[model samples]
Target: MVKTNAMRMLDKAKIEYTTREYEVDEQNLSGSHAADMMGADHGCVFKTLVLKGEKMGYLVCCIPVDGELDLKKVAKAAGDKKVEMIPMKDLQKITGYIRGGCSPIGMKKQFPTFIEESARSYSEIVVSGGLRGQQIALQPQSLIGFVKGRFASLMQD
Candidate 1:
């Protein structure tokens, strides 16, 4: 398996993680689909989202595949008046990752990151491995520390 920047970073940090691979479906690169392909629980699989905050510039939000990101909560957590998802066209240029492959770890620059509070209930959570068809499973607290992320209520009703 190819080592992505995320994996390498975790290695350098002495963090333990396991990688899972699945076939990428270009037409449907949803996190739930990836979880299903890997036979993993969707609630424990997260998708990285890049958002632009009015004051903070770029921020990364990681939430469970089965949940929606609550923009208002995100903004409050980010200490920004407003936040909006970055355009797909700007994702690569901004984070050095494509649509379905964006990982909270190993971005072009370390933007402020926030993970859903629900993740704290899990011993380990799955996140993109910096590429499609790949995922990295690791302790949630370890990941939060590695990315300098805080737990926030980011899920929508």
Candidate 2:
């Protein structure tokens, strides 16, 4: 098993998660693309996004592969009047993970993290493993427990 900071964090928290690794394809590295590469259902895969809310400068937002993030709703959920997606250059500084490899767990700093309600419906959800070509699969509750993330309707219709 790769001992990434993410895995170490999960281990420290005693959160149960399984990691899978694949070859990095420079052409396709997004969550949806990774799901397709892994032959996993898109609904079961999630993407981690960082946003700057009106009140909150940096927050973690997790949405499913097929879902679109509603910036307005996310801002409201964060108790911010408005929200803007954080820039790629600022991602590592904020979350400690690169754009295509950010995960909800093991961030350099703990920020308010929110997961879409849809994630709770699945038995397991896949997320970036803190590195390209890797993903972690785990139960929603475990993820919530580890990250202490709030559940919200941050997804768009």
Candidate 3:
């Protein structure tokens, strides 16, 4: 398995994680599809999202593939009036990772990060590994601490 910047960052931090790689399907690059490819539970697989806030500029959000991000809740957590997803074209420039490969760890710069509160229910969750066809599974708390993230009601009911 190829080591991505995210995996390296975790290694440097002495964070324990397991990497899983799957076949990439450009036409169907959804987290749920990735979860299916890895034979992982969809609820345990997270998709990292980058958003631009009215006041904060940029922020990172991680939520389960099966859930939807509550923009209002994210704005509240970010202390902004509103938040919108960054354009796909600007994703790499802003986060140094492309669409199907963005990770909460090892971005060009660490922006404020929020993980869905439900993540606390899982001992370990899967996140992108800074590259397509790769993922990292680690304790949610460890990931939250490493990224200096807070648990928020990020997902929609």
TM-score of 2: 0.95
| TM-score against truth, every candidate | 0.98, 0.95, 0.98
Candidate rank order under TM-score: 1, 3, 2
Over 4 Å off in model 2, which ranges? Answer: none
Tens-digit lDDT track of model 3 for 35-147:
99999999899999999999999999999998899999999999999999998999999999999999999999999999998889999999999999999999999999999
Judged by lDDT relative to the true structure, which candidate is superior, 2 or 3? 3
Each candidate: what lDDT? 0.95, 0.86, 0.95
Q: Judging by TM-score, tell me the better candidate of 2 and 3.
A: 3
> Global lDDT for candidate 1?
0.95
Q: How many residue pairs clash in each candidate?
A: 0, 0, 0
Q: Where does model 1 exceed 4 Å of error?
A: none
Q: Tell me the tens digit of each residue's lDDT in model 1 across 24-131.
A: 999999999999999998889999999999999999999999899999999999999999999899999999999999999999999999999999999999999999
